[model samples]
Target: MITLLRSRRSIRKFTGQKISKDIQDLLIEAMLRSQSSRNIRPWEFIIVDDKKKLEHLSKAKQHGSGLIKGAALAVVVIADTNKSDVWVEDASIASIQLQLMADSLGLGSCWVQIRNRMATDELSSDQFVKQALEVPDNYSVESVISIGYPAESPKPHSKENLQYDKVKYGSFSKPFYQD
Candidate 1:
């Protein structure tokens, strides 16, 4: 399990293969099991399988061009803004769990952050996305996740690239456990 978790990497390229329904269900199950703040779990999921809509969403979202071309499925994870402030955090945790589960299931996935109106300087924006998906105004699209079989194997992360000693700590600078 640790090896699988450590080996999971963001895959940008994918073959034109379709994902199995069973695998999709497993991914959703993993997502459902994710921990939520106060167990509120204020999340709404939208699965985009339509080719035309995927293309449109790619244009709307900055990092979703790959989603249009490579993904077998694109999941729009929305959080209810009207709900608790922790809703966003809860939704985000669920998204991460889904991605990891997808990886374990021999699927590739990438996270595309959905910036709010304040970040983009367009107050009435995201209306286009909402209208396209037919999502209620109370919900805000938090992230887009693209999943598919990988076209190419991801490059392995180097041990030199990670500063595990600095991150692990017994007391700040002190190492938690000496290697």
Candidate 2:
């Protein structure tokens, strides 16, 4: 897992190759296995592969979501607000799990945040996405994960680039970087 974590990077550019059904099934399983507080499991997954819908979702946000249109698959992560107070955290876990699973499967993925963002000055990204996908009012869109065969290969983050100063011991003043 550490090796996977070390090599994983967000991939925005993808080739035209479509993901296989078996691989997609594996990715869905990874999302389903995500852990949630009290196991409320309030999150839901939307697997979108249609080119037209992918193009539509690419505009969910103003600038950061354009990569979706090029992806072979995009998974929308959403949660039922009434199911848990920590639905955001739960949904976030599933989102990352999906990305990690994609990486393990030799696929590339990028996360597009939607919550608390805008599609335009007049529209909330959540609202725009929901309207496009026809999601229920009870659910909230947290993110859209774009996945596909990578067209551009990015080098893994080096250990030296990690901000070790952010780590601390028992006290915030005690830097754990020394350890």
Candidate 3:
């Protein structure tokens, strides 16, 4: 499972290929299996396949550039604000699950932030996305995920290149594990 998680990378480029319905259903099931706070499961998914809509979304949403033209499908994961304070956490888990499932199924995926502070302000990175998608007032558009076959393999980040010295134990400056 860790290998699968580690192997999963954000795929911005995709082949212009369509995914099967059965695979889509399986991905949905993976989302459903994600754990939520107190079982609230305060997440809603909107799958977009219409070419026009996808194209419009690419211009509207943050990090949606490659999604519109490359991905076979785009999913909007919304969190019900009225549910609980942990709604965002729940939605995020589901989003990761969906992405992991896509990777396992030999598909590529990338997450586009939609409900962050940057995406909602006056100088929003994706103000047009909210209006274009017609997101409801009651729900927060947490993210947009693009899924499709990869056009080119993404280079993996090297673990050795990461700064592990900054990591600490229960207290600051205390090493958790010595190199």
Candidate 4:
């Protein structure tokens, strides 16, 4: 698990290959098992594989969403705000779990933030995606994750690249002790 976490990378380029149904199921399972406040599990997902819809979603945000057009599949993460007060946090955790599961299965994924964002057409990202996908009014769009076979690989982040300066031991002036 640690190795998988260390090596996982956000991949924007895809080979355009289709993901198997088994892999999709695994991703969904991972999302469902993610931690949620009060165990309400208010998250909802929309799995989009349509090419035309993918193209339209690629324009959902002015930036950070071009990858959706080339992905084999895209999972739209939403949360039922009425069911959970901390819906966004819960949905975000689920999204990360889905991404990690994709990495473990040798697939690549990238998260495209949709909440409080805008599309190139000047519409709010959430509103545009809701209209395009016909999402229910009760749920709010949190993010869209693009998944596919990777066309390129990114080097994993290493301990050498970590910012030690930001880490505090007990108080602001104290440095972390390694023993």
**Candidate maximizing lDDT:** 2
lDDT of 1 by residue, 123-146 (tens): 323565677799898988877788
146: Cα error in model 4, Å: 0.4
Clash pairs, model 4 backbone: none
How many Å off is the CA of 82 in candidate 3?
A: 0.8
Name the top TM-score candidate.
2
Candidates sorted on TM-score, descending: 2, 4, 3, 1
Is candidate 1 or 2 superior in TM-score?
2
What alpha-carbon RMSD in Å does predicted model 2 have with respect to the real structure?
A: 0.9
Tens digits of lDDT, candidate 3, 1-179: 87776667899888888999999999999999999999999899989988888877776534445465567999878877898798889999999999999999999998887665353345453355657777776787777888999887876667786678788999997987686
For all candidates in order, the CA lDDT equals 0.77, 0.96, 0.80, 0.92
Q: Candidate 3: TM-score? A: 0.87
Model 4, span 31-102: residue lDDT tens: 999999989999999999999999999999877899999999999999988999999999999999999989
Roughly what TM-score does model 2 have, to 2 decimal places? 0.98
Cα-lDDT of candidate 4: 0.92
Clashing residue pair totals per candidate (backbone < 3 A): 0, 0, 0, 0
TM-score-wise, the better of 2 and 3 is 2
